[model samples]
Target: MSSMKDAREATFIGRRTDGTRIRRPLSPHLQVYDMVQITSGLSVLNRATGIAWTVGSAFLVWWLMAAASGPQALAKAQWFFSSFLGILVLAGMTAVAWFHTFAGIRHLMWDAGHGFDLPSTWKTGKAVMVATGVATVLTWLIALISW
Candidate 1:
């Protein structure tokens, strides 16, 4: 039992004044620390928007299935989709889509050896954000105007 304790202690790098052992920090421990860079935040947003876009695409499939089912099903789908809450969800989905698209472009630029510097990285991240916002808003505006 004493040897077991020694082994555990040896594994840890240090102990605090309160006698709590500290171990090596693991990757992706975002909750334990503050993010100081725009790049990190943009990276997180890129991943999150990707996930959201995938989930939102399910709604597209649902509408397509509804269309194939017949007029009644299509009518119900249209009604729900035209509702206020549905409009809000659609707006959110639109934003996520544009954000993910812009972020992916930014990544492709990086892969092509562009925007690797700190200032360029931050600028591109901000550009992606602003472009996503403008694109989403313009999409909704055109949709509403056409409707």
Candidate 2:
């Protein structure tokens, strides 16, 4: 049993014949790959925007809680939301939300076994970006007009 354990450990350690430890190959990372491709950028962006959306949803929850609290709390929340910095945050969250939505749709298409090829991937990525931009702008426009 001890010999078997030692043999297993020796194999795991992976020492070469020259008594040097064998080096494992590095996994692919950002430093190894070109990031110029739209598909890669969009894939990274989708994940990042998902995180952003979660953070943004916290603000929504706060607002809702304020509303439930009372008039004073709701007033304070409204004041903050109407401030310049608040407006900027809102705008960013809006864009993030729209981008996440479109990216999700793109992923669903891919899951359905469509758009696996490079050209299709590129086209879908570009379309998601364009749709996100247009939808975000239109949302803000309608919001401003109604305000």
Candidate 3:
């Protein structure tokens, strides 16, 4: 005896007519859509810059440990850093550390309720970015001259 069950009964298309609420509106309305000084467009970018700094810190720590192990290890690390890809990472890390540190101070000010105003925050953010850029260039320039 071949028993054939109803295959058509096994299906869910977003609703059961018996008595079940389907999709409800998302709670916590997105009523606040305006950007402010504390968490604005540019501030978000600073946060991402900080994340890069963290990654760079990890790379630096590993390189230091590798260098401390032996001369061969140090040579390998030196060769890697001197390579095109590693140099790119180093450059990015320099920028990231500068940007992240600069941004963190801004965040600290905000936490202290200091730079809450719009114009002041804007000016401060710009200053931080410029300073970061200058510092990064100066560091690379010094390193190049020394090398």
Candidate 4:
């Protein structure tokens, strides 16, 4: 047990010229990594959008429940939804929904053995971003014009 402990310690630590022990990092750290690239950034965004969509769905459920409860509840819900902050939240949720949809489609393509290469990954990432933006903007434009 003592020999094993020494072996582990020797492998993990180094002695400097002045006899000081220096510990080596156990794994690669963020500081050594390059700036976020499109592939990785989009992957993270995809996960974030998924969570945001789930939360947005909860809000939808609340709105539905409010409508089912009473006229007062429905009115309050409608007023909140029509407020500026609520509109901002709705717009963000819209973007999240679109982004999650596009990212899911991208993942389905990957599962089908497409976009495995670096260039294709980047292309698909950019495509998902653009599609999400366009869809979100168009959705809001239509809603506003109809209103």
Per-model TM against the reference: 0.79, 0.83, 0.71, 0.78
Compared with the true structure, all predictions reach lDDT values of 0.86, 0.87, 0.77, 0.86
Tens-digit lDDT string for candidate 1 (11-84): 54666789976764445667755665678888888889989988989989999999999999999988988999
Candidate ordering by lDDT (highest first)? 2, 4, 1, 3
- Model 3 score (lDDT): 0.77
Candidates 2 and 4: which is better by TM-score? Answer: 2
- Residue pairs with colliding backbones in model 3 are none
Report the lDDT tens digits of candidate 2 across residue range 1-147.
124444435544456788987644546788978786797788888999999999889889999999999999999988998899999999999999999999999899989998899988888889998999999999999989998
- TM-score top scorer: 2
Q: Candidate 3 — number of clashing residue pairs?
A: 0
Task: Show where candidate 2 strays beyond 4 Å.
Answer: 1-21
Each prediction's RMSD to truth? 5.7, 5.4, 9.5, 6.0
> Per-residue alpha-carbon lDDT of model 3 for 1-147, expressed as tens digits?
133265533332235487753543334423654454444656677778767777778778878998789889878888888899988999998888888888888889889989788788778988887998999999999989987
Residue-by-residue lDDT tens digits, candidate 4, 1-147: 124445566777766799987776667746675547887678788888988898789889989999899999988988988899889989999999999999999999999998799988888888998999999999999999987
Candidate 1, which segments miss by more than 4 Å at Cα? 1-28
